[model samples]
Target: MWVNLGVILLQFLSGSIMYSYIIARILKVDLSKIRDGNPGASNLWRAVGWKYGILALFLDYLKGALPLAIFVSLGIVKDNFVISLAALSGVLGHAFSPILRFKGGKAVAVSFGAWSVLTKWEAPMLLGTIFTIFTIIKPKGTTVQEDAFRVILGYLFLLPYIIYKSFHGDFHLLIFYDGNFAVILYKHYKDLWGYLRGQS
Candidate 1:
């Protein structure tokens, strides 16, 4: 029990680091005052530059990937439930970072990182392919709102594929994906609401 608790705590702390916010601070920019007022890689790109944004994205991805890698590699906890819980804790921490006063990013990138580790890279790679295809086919001048919608759609598409290709019979794994998707939608509630209301 103590080991499990420790792993959860460690994963959560790792995810709560807020890499974009840290990068914004280093660039002498306040992310809260920027586009969409989001302290995420996308807003960081608009606030500072793409280079910094890319760096932030990579760091945030590492926040999710490294901890799980360490825990699994070191044989700390091996149960699927514990692994899923620990990974989701990272996503939760990224979404509600205590270090950032409980406000944080939308968890897309961190989700990619955690799912990559959890699925041994298969899930993220497949989803990335889907996102890339969407990006390519999307009309020019696609607004951020449109892109956001596409991302959500892409994930929705991923759910069925994951179920079919990977977890066809594993109800628990399917539930884990559903929970992660729920967390993401909850975090993007405002954006999604605006899109639904024809404001986005």
Candidate 2:
């Protein structure tokens, strides 16, 4: 019981750290007044450059992946449930990082990292489709609203797969697995609502 509690606590702690903000600060960028008003890699990409964006993305991804790697290596979380929970911490971290006063990114990249470890090849397939769709549809300098649409379309593409896999297989391994994506969707709900209102 104590071991499980420890794992959960560590997950929360790991997920709460805001690495992107830290990177931004190191780069001498004030991320609180940027595009989307976020300290995420995307904002950092625009603030600094693509090189910084790539580096931030890598560090953000590694933060999640490294913790899961540690849990798997230490054998502290052998069950899929525990693994999923720990991985979700990274996504949650990206979404509501304590370092950023609980205001963080939309959790897309962190979730993608976690899914990559759990779902293997299918993970890249999902992420690639999202990237390709955005690249094709997004304008050269897309607004926040435009980016949100890309995100929604990316998620919509995976809806069928999520429903199919959850109902068709031993999906207990996916309890908090999809939570990462859901968190992102929840974060961007406001943008979605605006889009709906405009359509009507």
Clash counts for all predictions: 0, 1
How well is each residue in 76-106 modelled by candidate 2, as lDDT tens digits?
7677666677778777877888777788777
lDDT by residue (tens digit), candidate 1, 50-154: 898899899888888767778888888887778878888899899999978888888888888888777877778877887888778874645556656766876
Q: lDDT of candidate 1?
A: 0.81
Deviation in Å, model 1, residue 74 alpha carbon: 2.3
- Name the regions of candidate 1 deviating beyond 4 angstroms: 139-141, 165-170
lDDT of 2: 0.72
In order, candidate lDDTs are 0.81, 0.72
TM-score of 1: 0.91
In candidate 2 the C-alpha lDDT for residue 180 amounts to 64
Candidate 2: pairs in clash: 15-93
TM-score of each: 0.91, 0.86
Give the total clashing residue pairs for model 2.
1
Q: How close is candidate 2 to the true structure, as a TM-score?
A: 0.86
